[model samples]
Target: MPENVNYYHITPLVNDLERFFNKYRLLAVESKELGIKLETKDLATFKPFPNKIYVMGSLKLSRNRKAKGILIRKEGKPVLNYSVASLWEFERSPDRIERSKVIVDYTISPKEAIPKEYGNLFTDDFMLWEGFSGMGKGGGRPAVFEGKPLVLPSLIRITPDELEKEFLCRNLGGIWTPKHKASAENRITRLQTFGNTFFPMMSRQYFPISWGSWESFRLEGEKYPALEDAVEPNV
Candidate 1:
């Protein structure tokens, strides 16, 4: 197995906020079972998880190069209020080199999540295809390919600084993170699941299952349970 495969993350389709939160809760529970803790926080207040996974919630970006705030929940609904200096802090931090992070954004409702103004900076069809193809063992397909190249809002191991300077600034046209590439290749080559039970169940899901190498096989069977069996019951 290749190195640097130490985290697995699933960024839900954000067309429906309620569904997004529901999926987040389920992912958190599954991560916990694998001895990994995932947290949702504003970029400014973000802290390293130290061998764990951190899922970023909605990030409000402005044209002024400063983050307006983050999306949070109140009264069982989504709200945006948490403030941040800049998304670049992810790279400035000393611990970032050793830490693994995945940006959990969604492609659903692109207008609402990623506006046209920032399209050049965030949209990348080739990278999205590469990542998904690698994750699903060559069976995954891009979700937002509307007659054009697909766009993946979620990214792994890429800091805002690199994103702006290397990818966006240079007009690179796609993600250039080496760790993400390595992780994708590693997963495609090493990660394997058996039995038609989990395979068919996973195939029926609407969302893609993009995970990192940090995840353990012990949780594989439980990770992608059938929808009917996976949904949590109302209290």
Candidate 2:
């Protein structure tokens, strides 16, 4: 097995229990209405649930106009003429519209962070250094290599505030290359401008396990609780 394949256990916060259950109930009701033949026992076991249909209440319906034309030859004295005509069509319309969208994921893990235990799997090229000891002044060496930080994959269960802070501090540097400095600055500005609203919007929604397929649910406005509230019922 690959060293990076670390299994993560995610638990939702306590406050979100009621809402999660409610959504599950709604899903069950909808499934029944569609005559999908869901097994209660399987659902109760927390098997993968089928993809639930959700209305993007935040998005407005869009209208599209379509037209068709046909070419025909008309009788002429010396040359043939072409005639074009338009076909009848209906006007398109938008559904619902909103300002933002919420993304819910069961698992949230760093795409690039490496786990400490898997240190051997990585080479010097992938390592990041910090905390320079000897530099400038006399003949001094460059920055020294420090131990690698532990990065592991886990379920999404952090508070928005914490995430925002971490995002801001992640790129702070004592000595940075031009590329690193620019990237850090961009991230800092983005977090400062949208940190509060951004983190909550990115919160992932948790659902009951079902034997079926996983489904996503969308709601109008930002009425749902933050992802931090989404906790497993038994937990």
Candidate 3:
């Protein structure tokens, strides 16, 4: 269970989001691992596949858009729009998003920080010496926001240099890298951004686990109160 999860709320110019996601690389990888079959020709045939998060349909708001992520329950609490990479900040990162609920102290709500001037698009500045996203330093030493204060989570990677730059740039670097595109194969390219050093660990960590493993129904009813039991098995 990831302790911290980050969301990159991208409201792109792409028109057919469903088509884009169906053929999207990362989604495909996720589908393949989950035994999900998606076809661009069949939209209704899809479902996130009965999967907990099948695309959820893109979010929309006239003045602003919404995209929630990695929704999980921590200690029976709910965590929405969290970062998977940020989980490293959790003292006990079991990679179980379901086990851990959102910690108010940990979230710095980005809605207010939306860089609308940058085109009505922007995320809150969760970049701290140790926030949910990666760190930043700007210079070789990583500035305050860029500086890394702890280990990185599996789905997210931050290099020594990445931790130094300011949030003004870099957080969404992967998307521009062509790897994070809607095309799908971009998933590899997206993960490839981790480079050789971190990608190895991240690759292994991001592997698809059985669905019920990462998902929990505590909020949905099948209750299990022991949220953070180290003795419990990991997905």
Candidate 4:
């Protein structure tokens, strides 16, 4: 019942620019958990989803090295939701051979209580996760931030990138592309009540989908409802 689990991420930023980021960690505080690292590489080239986050520039961790995936949004959606852990077959799947990283909690990195006096109003780099079973070592009990709770470190790392070309072709709120022209699906029908994986992504020749009853389970589980706990924690 111990497959190395620890995850926690909270970056509430907005102004004060946290000194333009130069290394600010508050993870695990001293080892109760919060040790995330796994970027083994290759998850079928790319195209695996659950919210979404994949890119590489600087978060500190390099093993196989070949990273160049980028996805982020706010007025668009996505806050770090992509999952893989051998779909709960868990013997050890920090995404079990790639898809690993952890480093976030930049003392509330620009989460905005009212800061933005200048730049960084759309994304100064973001990442946060307390899921994918971040509190693994057992189950239930870990979930504390700003008061000191352990178990949190599956992976967290992101900083400084060219992420301002309009956050480049977003895909979290539905129909960012795949050529989604949106003649009038009502913005994909108001983004299907908070994104039901945008329902088969509307047939995806880019877009042409149609839905109704149960939105067809909205991309129903194969391992992505925030990863259903990337499995393996009977600890």
Candidate 5:
């Protein structure tokens, strides 16, 4: 019998957003195989989870940076769900140092990558991630807007002094201190989520199988789900 080795690369794209999400799904399955459970419920109603996980972010390589894949935390342990190299390769155990580096790089300057509509809302260093609920201690503010609740699936950057004011003025879904800023930000930077003040958010969606299930897995592997193969691939 021959070894089952697979090659991976980012896929070409006609639709950018569609491809990015496809990569996200692949990463989710890889996370599952690593024993990291998918959090399906709203993250707002419970005590804060100890890990600040980022489901998607840009990866910096020697040549250039590519916007794709990220690390997710489960039960207080960091798991390298997917990376640029994950499109074709599967690792039983990713290196701890690489995992730490991915988490750190995930929080770097994401200003340019932010959506145009969300521009005026944030002007400081920020990190974007899904599954954010502004409840619990140090979990930011309650996600309320115009007497209604909002679903926060993204993370933003702010300052400690501006925390209270931002929540009130920007109608932020919630505002709170980042428990691990000293390490994640390496400075006094606060994190926030989208609210309905400037660009209102839609209610959260409930998925029966969650966003990324092994039900979508393939045996031969996939191309990087990027619009371009220039950076890296993880489809």
Candidate 6:
């Protein structure tokens, strides 16, 4: 038998994403062999899905927004990419007129820093959060905030130099990168100013499994306890 295999599921709700990532992180810890890919479904269909993940539906955050993402798999112990996991938050604009729409609190897992029996699958690639109805990075998605739209480089490839420069701007909230509307030279200044507060910066650590009742944001859910045993290997 080979070693890796991947399966795909469209995560239409925040709770589902939280649950999947919890499972993904646990499997990584135990060095289990399994693969799962979660693609963000169009926000339009979110309400129909079971389990009202958040009460912000009235906020209309999904009315015109959509997110996208990948594919793969192997056999035996599948070679899963830790990059598949991410933590997102919806920041309410200080003005209340324009919500941040999406804020990626954490993307890289902290465990990757320590030596592990299995190994690490961490990467610096930033998660893509497009706007303008998915037409391009800058458009009217859900709601256009006061500042320039949140955009980043193509997830497919990011140069080493860019990664290094972006790292310098990491802050408390988390991060997203590769500047869309700004020049490479002005990247740091622009990012340090708005990026820190907006996207924050993707941090290295496991995000909380549950988000208590927080009315300011839409991403919230009950705790998804870890599995007692290694998940069944990808069949």
Question: Number of the top candidate by lDDT?
Answer: 6
Each candidate: what lDDT?
0.24, 0.19, 0.22, 0.21, 0.22, 0.24
Residue 91 local lDDT, model 6: 28
Please provide, for model 1 over 1-235, each residue's C-alpha lDDT reduced to its tens digit, 9 standing for 90 to 100.
2231121222222122222112221122112222323233311221112233443332323332222112111122111111111111122233322212222222222222322221111112233333333333321343334354433333233234533343322223322322333222222111111121111001001122222111222233332211122122121
Cα RMSD to the true fold for all candidates = 20.0, 25.1, 18.5, 20.8, 19.9, 18.2
lDDT tens digits by residue: candidate 2, 124-223: 1111111111111111111111232322111122354555445443344311112233231122112222233211222223221111000111111122
Give per-model TM-scores.
0.22, 0.16, 0.18, 0.17, 0.20, 0.22
lDDT of 4 at 39: 33
Clashes of 1: 7
Clashes of each: 7, 26, 41, 26, 9, 13
lDDT by residue (1-235, candidate 3, tens digit) is: 3533212221111112223122211221112111222222211111223433222222221233222222212232222222222111111123311111111112223312322211111122122212212212110211222333422221333443542331122355432122223231112223223222321112212111101112221232211112231111122
**Candidate 5 lDDT, tens digit per residue, 111-157?**
12222211011101111111111211111122222234332223222
* Candidate 4 per-residue C-alpha lDDT over 1-235 given as tens digits, one digit per residue, 9 for 90 to 100: 1122212212211111222222222111111122222232312122123233321231121343322121111122112222211110111223322121122221222211212221111111211122211222212221222244322212222221312221223554533332334332211211111132111111111111111111111133322112222211121
Worst 10 contiguous positions by lDDT, candidate 6 = 22-31
> What are the runs in model 6 whose C-alpha is more than 4 Å off?
1-5, 8-45, 48-51, 55-77, 85-235
Model 4 misplacement above 4 A? 1-114, 117-144, 153-235
**Lowest-scoring 10 consecutive residues by lDDT in candidate 2?**
209-218
Model 4 residue 38 CA deviation in Å:
17
Report lDDT (Cα) of residue 227, candidate 2.
Answer: 23
Q: Between 4 and 6, whose lDDT is larger?
A: 6
When sorted by TM-score, best at the front, the candidate numbers are 6, 1, 5, 3, 4, 2
Query: What clash count does candidate 4 reach?
Result: 26
